[model samples]
Target: MAILKLSAAERRRISAFFTCLVLALVAWVITVLSSSYNYTVKEIITFKNAPLKRAFHSLQSDTVNITVKGTGWQMLLSKIREANHQIKIDLSPLDYEDFVVVSSQLPAINAEKAIHNQIIAITPDTLYFDFTNRSVRRVPVRLIKSIKYMPQFTQSGLSIIKPAYVTISGPSNLIDKIDVWHTDSLVLKNINEDVTTALNLRVPAEGNISVYPKTVQVTIPVEEYTEKTLELPVKLIGNVDYYNVKLFPQKVKVTFTTSLNRYADIDEELFEAQADLNLWRTYGISTLPVKVVRMPAFCKLVSVEPGNVDFIVKR
Candidate 1:
């Protein structure tokens, strides 16, 4: 009791010493508190080297669980996206092997209390994604024209080009599956002498393939009938010169392929061939415009025996 009583200076020195000890104790507590925490370590995720287009579609899901540990304060401060937070882990660089995934130290984050540092589980919905290789290729495209047939005419007659095949190259996986592609179709009406038509080409339903050259030539077969005499209609193609005059045979001998069904109701009056006499006069030529006056509409002009004749007129 006697020693407890001290001078003012002694009391002041003892008080300062106590204060310093208390401060040191407080500092130690704070350091310990900050170091201990409950963190969650979540599951591991796997990713493959997929095509760019397909990879973009895989990130639609939200909320991945990762486990962490630390003190309540430290854990609470841990957030998914802090200035130093790491929200996701990449597994692309790792080789495939059987091993347990461990928690990787990340930056401080503010986590919800509910997420109290605990070992969490994580998983993905899809696995084994297919990587597509997209490439451009040159494919042989044939024209397949769509035609409407007359009522009650159920493709009575039709002809297609032989060896209907084209070469196309693209991605190995995509091109390998295509054995053959088809064009649309060509339809016809009744009472037709002979008609030539074009068709367009298209890809099969199961393929997403594209062709480089978008178009190819296709000729539709025409069926013709026999005709003893058919009128050749005159066709005025190019404009006649001011001083030139054209003359037509006025009639043509028509012969068709021997088919009764083909000749029926056929229009053979739309063909005509005329010789220009004005051209001969202008050139001061004696033998000019010596072509046949006309030929049958159904008959294709093979060769004009005497393509020209001598028509002389004094200029």
Candidate 2:
């Protein structure tokens, strides 16, 4: 490595040159920011202090494009600020109309006074909104969930929702059409145990519609299932005139699977197995298929021994 030393005058000149360069860069930035420029931006419009008895339904527009002229710094700050430009329209003094113009009802903008941005023009300066009579109703809430249980597991009882219903307040037309509200779709696969979760309800984009309880708690009861077998008598259906009908197997073994809590509640009498004799009389078929006429709701029929049985008729 070689060391080079500079004279005092040369070091001073180098230092002054870099300082001037930095100053020039700062000056350029200041000039660009201070200069006035025109820019177009989107502003969201929101209403406040709406009448309790009346609801503001369909709005002609929720946003408007406004052209503003101000310094570059002012424009940049406005774009980066977190505050939203809102226009409040007092509805207490206004009468009910099919549509109302918002420009005339718009209150003065006091929040933007500090920004010092001149509003050149606002597109669709005349805003319009549809008004309707407000109404409230209590509607049931339904849970939307896709659930699958593992092997040997089944839902024991009905699924319960903490708050079975919700209150909705909106336009009379919209409220009359809504009978129920549903939660967001949820999926649970291979669930072996009970599940409880809180889910949000579906929210409409319409500004006039509103739900009192936005979220609800759902509980799914699951239990282990056991297989049970029962010997049920097979009755002969239809009339057998002048002929004695005898099935090879008088009784059938009805195998079913149900939750443990409901296993003892099931019995052979709950199920009805019968073979139709009309088929044999009409078609002269010796073998007839046995069908289960009734069964418990909680019990799932697995199989029926000797699904088809032969009948012998002799006088």
Question: What C-alpha lDDT values do all the predictions have?
Answer: 0.44, 0.79
Could you estimate the TM-score for every candidate? Answer: 0.28, 0.73
Candidate 1: tens digits of C-alpha lDDT, residues 127-217: 2322345444343344445554443222224444433556554445776666655666554445233344445566433222444333344
Best by lDDT: 2
Tell me model 1's lDDT, rounded to 2 decimals. Answer: 0.44
> Which parts of model 1 have CA positions greater than 4 angstroms off?
1-228, 231-259, 277-306, 309-315
Question: CA lDDT of 184 in candidate 2?
Answer: 92
> All candidates: CA RMSD in angstroms?
23.4, 5.0
Which ten-residue region of model 2 has the weakest summed lDDT?
105-114
Residue 92 of model 1, lDDT score: 40
- Candidate 2 C-alpha lDDT tens digits along 1-315: 999899999999999999999999999999999999998888776655555677666456777776778888988888665275644444444345544454444335433434667666666766556677888999999888888899999787788997999998888988899888999997899999999999999986677777878999999889999999988888898855857878889888889889988878888778899999999889988788888889987778899988988888876
Return the TM-score for candidate 1, rounded to 2 decimals.
Answer: 0.28
